[model samples]
Target: MIRFENVTKVYDPNARPALDAVNLEIDRGEFTFLVGASGSGKSTFLRLILKEDRATSGSVYVAGQNVANISSWRVPKLRRGIGVVFQDFRLLPQKNVFANVAFAMQVIGKSRSIIRETVPEVLKTVGLEGKERRMPHELSGGEQQRVAIARAVVNRPGILLADEPTGNLDPITSMGIMGVLDKINQNGTTVVMATHDDDIVNEMRKRVVELRNGVVVRDEARALYTSMIPVVGESRRMKDASDAEIDRAQGVQQ
Candidate 1:
């Protein structure tokens, strides 16, 4: 459902590319993990799929449409087919869980009846059926993230992109989030997640693509994390870059 052909993204003329000549493909219904240390181009990889940042060179196709060929006015329509969840949760503080999930459909001009029917279904899919009234601050970290997941999938997007979804949660909580993601993938949404959680990566034994300094060092259909790589400062730095990409995309849409 996703393909990148010799993609390279250079932020500055004087600096190296965030993603260098990376060619990858993710099939429909496949769950893949993009695992790498911070600054290894994981975030950049995800952003390219979202069209949040265009590759400096090459092509990115999502579900047969080349994102670079999609016009600015049509970006929202492109985004509607993909759901993105970030490490930050990115919830509206004042909005309750139901409103937050329902907001996605509302922005897309879904009918009140459709929203009413859809929101509860997705909430139940993410195991958040009874917590619709809870505000972001009122829920636990895992629960808040579940709400975020619910929001992402309410529209039943063809692809799900999660960036460090478990970075902020405890081990047990992270496992729970992974379970929810797995469930989503099983239900037939293509899932591509970028994460630094080695233990989770090793345990899940899914398709793994490891990037190092913008190069795809490893791509295995099934693999472990190989080693414990400590990327203490890089995670936050990469996340900041991803956040900036989101802000830029929103600014353009506005």
Candidate 2:
């Protein structure tokens, strides 16, 4: 679970705040989408949760503890309960698939036997069972991203944060990645993803939080990419036709 109370983040005194007076909460086992244009504070919101960037004002709580109150020495421990995936698959080029996943556990002082047992299972979960020996360059774009997802969740983090996770892949591939993420959420890992793909958001119909100019404009459950407004005559018919097309696209992917 995560909560932000009247949070504001300012990088420079002369510039506007990246986030301003934003209060939001994400409950355990819920999947939420942070939707906005560029520079709309989506990434800043995530960094505050991770304590990668300190809030200029107000409080951020993760799992009931104020992230700002946590000591610098304990930040690593806090991050161990959260998993992060990025738009760019940040796989270690020199390390094969198995080692890349195992490294997360190893850095936390997990035993070799544990790493050996856990890495393969996670890789298989992400649909990479037979590719354990492959290098990052040898995998396709989607497969590389799957490897990144596997590495992030190998430790079974309580929360998963994905920032533009499907930005680099084709629609079909993005759907596949979303399927993997959905499976993780079903098992009770809270998922918060930031994305700009309208089709994906509209298809998933999850809780959507829209931000603009560092302010929360809309937060709705089972929402589409944007608010729909009433239209008249031919325009209404056109809108209905467009929605039908989107539904067809998603059906084909499924």
Candidate 3:
């Protein structure tokens, strides 16, 4: 439900573009991972989709409309169809879990009765069912992140964008968060996550789109974090074998 055509984003005339001729398409109900080092244009790619930043050149289409063609006043409406989760878990400290999630619907002018019904259901989906009355500080890091995820999806957005979602949690906790995300994906939300955690990417074996210096170097289905192929079009069987070997080595180390 997202497409980018020769997209390039430049912040300064003297500096290099944050994204350089990047082309990508993410279909509905697909779970994809955007893996790269710092400054590899992952965040920039997301911002373009959200229209938080305008593309310096080319087009970005989300949910059938070109983001660049959307009027400024309509941006909010566009975002309502998309959910976003961040690494920091940006929960409201003063609000309890239920209120935090309900606020998302409230801001969109949803009735209190609807908010009351929806918030609890979403919290349950994120595994925070009984913790609704607790405030942000009262929850653990993973729980707080779950609250964030609940808030993001309360409106049933068509696409979910998670940027470094598990970056702050332990590996086990991160896996739990991934499980929550996977469930949401299965329920028909298209998921695009940007992450640097190799173990998580390798273990999940999802579609991976690797970026290097703002350019997409690899896009593979059921792929590992690291590519065994020195070149893009190498044998898939060889890559799978190499990934298996890497997993074994990691297991031995553990």
Candidate 4:
């Protein structure tokens, strides 16, 4: 569902690259986690896929569209179908829960006919149906995040990108959000989540991609994060740079 080939992202000419030649692929209906530290290029990698920032060189393709080289005219169309939830939970302060989720469809120019039929269904899916009339401040942190997730999945996009999604919540609330994501993944939307929550990562036991200093140190199928990392271990250091660089290089542009 997503592919990155030879992708590199250098923030400034002199600054170290945010994502150095990142190459990876995520399959449809898979729940994958990107585990990395604050400056480890996980956010940069997510932004590359979102086209919020372009790779300095290489290609990023989503749903087979070459995003690295995507035409300017079609960028909006590409994003309209994909759902993104950031660590901050970008919600409209004035909009209530239902309107917040419904607003996504409205902004995309989806018809009132469609909105009327879809909004409540998605709200129900995210377990926010009764709270639809309440304002953002009226909801708890977890509920507000669920509202964000409802908005994201309302359009039924095939891929979901979440960055630090459960960052602020307690463990139970965080797991609640994870459950929503897992449900969405099970229903066939692809999920690529980037997080630093070690407990959650260990408990989920999903595909794990570990990045350090903008390089992929580990990409293991059904992987477990054995240690707190980019600090993997001496054995990881012995792996060939070419093998590590191989992932960096697979992004659409690197």
Instruction: Choose the strongest candidate by TM-score.
Output: 3
Compared to the true structure, candidate 1 yields what TM-score? 0.88
lDDT of 4 by residue, 68-134 (tens): 6678888887887689997778999999888999899998898998998999888888888778799
Task: Output the TM-score of candidate 2.
Answer: 0.89
Q: List the residue pairs that clash in candidate 3.
A: none
lDDT for each candidate structure: 0.90, 0.92, 0.92, 0.86
Error of 2 at 113 (Å): 0.6
Q: Candidate 3: how large is its RMSD?
A: 5.9
TM-score of each: 0.88, 0.89, 0.91, 0.89
* Candidate 2, 1-254: lDDT as tens digits: 99999999999879889999999999999999999878879999999999999999999999999999899999998999999999998999999999999999999999999999999999888899999999999999999999999989999999999999999999999999999999999989999999999999999999999877677777889999986544557545644665586689789999
- Candidate 4 deviant stretches above 4 angstroms: 227-235, 238-254
Once fitted onto the true fold, the runs of candidate 2 whose alpha carbons sit more than 4 angstroms away are 229-254
Model 3, 118-186: lDDT tens per residue?
Answer: 899999999998999999999989999999999999999999999999999999999999999999999
- Sort the candidates on TM-score, descending order: 3, 2, 4, 1
The number of clashing residue pairs in each candidate reads 0, 0, 0, 28
Give the local distance difference test score of model 1.
0.90
In Å, residue 219's CA in model 4 sits off its true spot by 0.6
